[model samples]
Target: MRKRERLELIKKLILEHKISTQQELLDILENAGQTLTQATISRDMNEIGIIKIPGPDGSYIYGLSKDKLRQEGHRIDETPSILAVSPLVDGLEKMIHVDVVPGTSRLIKRQLLTKYKEMIFSLIADDDSLLLVAKTDFYQQVIRQKLESMVVSDEQ
Candidate 1:
């Protein structure tokens, strides 16, 4: 299937069912006669700005951004904070993992690119999340704090 079609199916599945993981989504697609891999689904989710929201039972389920849902009057149950996803800090590797709301990653990346062009070694994005590799611990701290503040401000 084309990326657009695949993304539409994903959105439909999420709206119709509580899809919690990439594997579950893949299974659903396969049962519907579409063959796809977990990685493909992940990339598609990223492309379409899908993020995981906390489900009623505590597990996370795929959700559209508030910007998309507002017009439809579907309320998102939880408001995510920057720390809700838990940043994974790897001191040994000088890398930090940050989970952001979809669409926000691109904004964050653009801002970081302009501000930390020299200190950041690399920035990788996947769905509503990103990994930042810094040239030093100082850079990592700076980037992490700035990102956290940005996310919080956006949520407000």
Candidate 2:
């Protein structure tokens, strides 16, 4: 499987179980039909920003890094990243929200596909705007908020 696919699976496993150590995480991967070394699990943990929080048994289970919230989050909305793109289409679910400068849609689209393929399913890009298809509608609001903040930051 691709690194992105592995990461996605890892995320799913982490959410499903209380991962306490590298060995446990590795075992989860192997059970999922992907095997990796302790080093790879370490790297994945860091990359995904996993957190070690105290579990009921007094051991720390890997958890969603709260820092991710600081980085940013979003909610889906009617205004799809751009004017033309939309939630209007049936089965056209959104997965990410990203923004780029005017006339840089193609550039942004390329970069997103290259850099954040895991976070997005499909993409639509136009001048200064981009729409990302996500696994769930929950990400749409996050995308919208992140893009709005970027626009605000640019104005500042």
Candidate 3:
């Protein structure tokens, strides 16, 4: 499998299983019929910022680092909310909370501004929440409209 696909599979397994060692990871991949070398695994681990955490079995298991410090200068403790939105000409910032899956936050953060360029400056995303800081009220308004439109009604 390609590196990108392999990495995604590794992440899926780690989230779904109790993996504590490279051997276990290797077994998982092998069972899935994709072989990987230890060196490749180690490199993938470092690239993805995987870390070990204490588990109930008195052993440390591999998992993604959820620490804010590991995040790219975005403080997770910062309770982000849509503070305000002003027109671009008026000079204001907009903020909003986006509820998304934890694993997809990084992917969303990478291209938010480019994908939605109307009024976003930056984004701070965690497991299930994203703080979008808009560069102008126009952007804020646009984002709010998009979000509201995306809201799904509970129905059969």
Candidate 4:
């Protein structure tokens, strides 16, 4: 699997289970038909900002970093905001196109997915742009407004 796919799977597993060890994560991935090494998993975890937080049972388990949880009112990292470069949001129907700073599209895509999961059907990020497919044209407009509002809030 690709690194992005593996990262998404790791996030899913971490969210669904109280995984506390690299070995356990490795085993789960293996069972899921993914052949990965401990080192690769370690790197993926760090890349995605996964950390060990207290689970319900008082033991530590893998979880997303609070800094990465934008939906929970946490401030995202100091990368440029979605409108920092004046992202061009254009759409014909259910698809919206956004121009982003080079190398920041993936981060923007992740935040958008987290904050607007129900509205987004699929999101693709390239080096300097994002293509977001919403459930409908109305949802696409909502996403566009939200992106603009992010810049407004950031400016205030």
Candidate 5:
């Protein structure tokens, strides 16, 4: 598999499982049919900004770095609803457009890129809008659904 695909899988595994050691992560990957060396996994984890955070039982578990997310303007304490006001999401062909609160387009863009990097070809953001070019029509629809789900209704 390609590096991007492998990285995506690693992220998913880390998020979905309590992976503590490099050996444990390697074993899980091998069980899933991914054959990679521990050195390569370590490099990939570093490249993707994954870090060991304190788990529930005081052990360290692999997790995405909150510092990196904060540096990207994504507040770890705030949800998407706080950054956007009923964002308008629309898509056509292989492109998806999202309209969010002014000054928050960049944050939303960063979130989208982080979550859907493999599906996205290019993403551009202005003061209150974003234009994402997906790798395929299917990816465009998937991205549209994800953006739409983040929309908060004024009624709620």
Candidate 6:
């Protein structure tokens, strides 16, 4: 398998099971017939922006940074980060809600505006989330889909 294929497998493995260490990941890859070294796995993890987050059992599991929702003692969900994609209107009629990694909200907002400047009215950035205000429901859906697509592509 190519490096991208292996990385995708690694992401799948992380999502499927609570993988906390490089050795565990290597063993899983070995079982799947992809022989890779610990160093390679480490490099891949870095390249893919994987981080260890606290699981339900208080053990750390590898996942994308954006996968974490910072609430006190909250356990990380098994669902892939991309799976958290949802666009819901807030109490305000034109406001839409979405979350991203802590530091990248501004960049994502900029990208969203750049891509859908006509549809998106404004973006309100929070600590680790974004509230997108679009011109209409149709425009909101378009914005949501675009944001979700960006996140899903990042996972690859």
Each model's lDDT: 0.71, 0.60, 0.65, 0.74, 0.75, 0.68
Model 1 TM-score (2 dp) = 0.55
lDDT of 2: 0.60
TM-score of 3: 0.44
Residue-level lDDT of model 6, residues 103-142, one tens digit each, is 4455456556777889978888753677778898788776
Question: Candidate 6: which stretches are off by over 4 Å?
Answer: 67-156
Q: What would the per-residue lDDT of candidate 3 be over residues 8-123, giving only the tens digit for each residue?
A: 88877876888888899999889999888999997887667665644678777776655423464534432222222223333334677666533435544554666796567877
Runs of candidate 3 with Cα error greater than 4 angstroms are 1-27, 30-93
Q: Write the per-residue lDDT of candidate 5 for residues 12-66, one digit (tens) a residue.
A: 8988999888999999999999989989998898777776655799866777765
- How large is the C-alpha RMSD of every model relative to the true structure? 6.1, 14.8, 11.6, 11.1, 12.9, 11.7
* Winner of 1 and 6 under TM-score: 1
Q: Residue-wise lDDT of candidate 2 within 10-75, one digit each (tens)?
A: 877887897777798888778878879888887886677665554689756776544443355623
Q: By summed lDDT, which 10 consecutive residues of candidate 2 come out lowest?
A: 74-83
lDDT of 1 at 24: 87
Steric clash pairs (candidate 5)? none
Looking at model 4, residue 117 earns an lDDT score of 96
Top candidate by TM-score: 1
Mind giving the per-residue lDDT tens digits that candidate 4 earns over 4-44? Answer: 88899998898898898889999999999998988899889
Q: Alpha-carbon error at 141 in model 1, in Å? A: 7.3
Winner by lDDT: 5
Q: Residue 45 lDDT in model 2?
A: 68
Best of the two (1, 5) by lDDT? 5
lDDT of 1 by residue, 1-156 (tens): 777787788888988889877888888889999998778787787666676766789777887765567656877544543543345544445677777754456545655688998989998876577777889988877877776664545435
* Per-prediction backbone clash count: 0, 11, 3, 0, 0, 0
